[model samples]
Target: MSFDRACRVNVGLREPNVAFEKEDWAVGVDRGRLLVIAEHVAPGVPAIAAAVRSAPDDKSAMTELAWGLRGAGLAAYIDWAEDPEDVQEALNSLRSRPGAMSWDWWDDEDCEDCDEAEVIERFLGLAGDHSRRYGAILFEIEQGGDGYLVGFMEEGSVGMLVDNRSLRVVATGWQNRA
Candidate 1:
């Protein structure tokens, strides 16, 4: 079976539904650095969708807005969906499934003679170790040498609000997760 990522985040506001009315905003982080803070058409922050015309394909094209560091009082009220373990689980699934040679090697015919060490490393790269509360950030939407609305943000960095909550949240999260 294929893995699906259907995560969402709502901050200090009622979540937007498909019927209309998406008045929530979003924040993007990268490499422990704050980058772009934008608004969403729907209440879905982490939910992938278009800026205005949301569709399955529009997830990475949402518009961005300018907000200050910890200016929005949303850090405290932030709520998001479950952190995804899709890539990690998918890689592991290959190990338990029948007809699969091993989890450390490539399955495609192109890698018939590929190096074993490289193959294992590449396969293991799919697994991510994310913060328990802040969550894992594995992908970014970059094009033409920049991350669309998140150009200022780096790829694979955790997004966080620059408020007192960030310290407590991160500290507590790590302590608990650790």
Candidate 2:
């Protein structure tokens, strides 16, 4: 099975004239869906025009924009710019979890009879389920070949990362660490 490992920046832009420099990275901006994965930049890197346009001058504007993005079902990771304190608190709570980076089933011995594909599917499903529960934004990280690291960002910061392996998901760490 093949997986598309490209990490896309999904944005909901108010402006229609915005364009990107790297044509290769430009996925396409379709207003019809109101959810466009237009730019395929490296993970954690925001699209230039989207970033600039989303960024407002004042705190009130920033908060308003952040809400607008969220309301439009856009996962822009704009909470950091909107409210850093709340985001930090959420991160702290996530990191404090005893099982944040460790799981009992995350070992070969624990799932010796388990199929690799099934394990991957379960991990992905869990990630999605948690994302919805926490109202988080999902990010994908390419880990070479068929390997991928999925991150769930809630309240602007990363709350969890899951991988195909029963091991090394947490060991990989967050953001650039992957």
Candidate 3:
């Protein structure tokens, strides 16, 4: 089957019908898919499109865009206490699924016997480090035809794709699948 993956974020806008160039935002993103997602999350807002245009620079654009979305009630920031548990659970669950593979060598360490608590602790530590070093972290879960993909995109990273500043693919057992 053909690969299909989607990343969705809720976006709120003051002016739903504000006209903006969708193509100019998140350049690497699929416009058609974004349009559909925009329709579903906040009809007529085109939040991503607007934010990209409004941001000051390309390096900080995603961070600015995310903040703008959060301010408008479109996106959410992870609460380290509770959210990391859920994120850990998702990662552990993905490990059991077929075709699971670690995108980074560090993430491939032996953890077959690790319990929920241990997993969560590790995840929290990682999240903490990411936040301290990268300013903020944006969690993303992508559902694909083959499987699910998870990521922690750091604000310090350049481009839409993850780079040195981004968190390791530990939280996503099937990383880079998108």
User: How many clashing pairs in candidate 3?
Assistant: 3
Q: Could you tell me how far off, in angstroms, the CA of residue 85 lies in candidate 3 after the best superposition?
A: 5.6
* CA lDDT, every model vs. true structure: 0.23, 0.31, 0.35
lDDT (tens digit, per residue) of candidate 2 on 41-123: 12333443254345443222323433443333332232212232333233234321223432322343533564654444344
**Tens digit of lDDT per residue, candidate 3, span 1-178?**
1111211121121221223343333333333333333233333456665655555654245444445444545444433344344554443343111223332333525445756445444554454344334343333422112211233333343123222112122323213233
Q: Which wins on lDDT, candidate 1 or candidate 3? A: 3
Which numbered prediction scores highest in TM-score against the true structure? 3
Sort every candidate by TM-score, greatest first.
3, 2, 1
- Give per-residue lDDT, candidate 2, residue 45: 32
Worst 10 residues of 1 by lDDT: 143-152
Clashing pairs in 1: 31-157, 49-58, 49-59
Model 3 regions more than 4 Å off: 1-43, 46-48, 79-172, 176-178
| Candidate 2, residue 54: how far the Cα is off, in Å | 20
The lowest-lDDT stretch of 10 consecutive residues in candidate 3 is 1-10
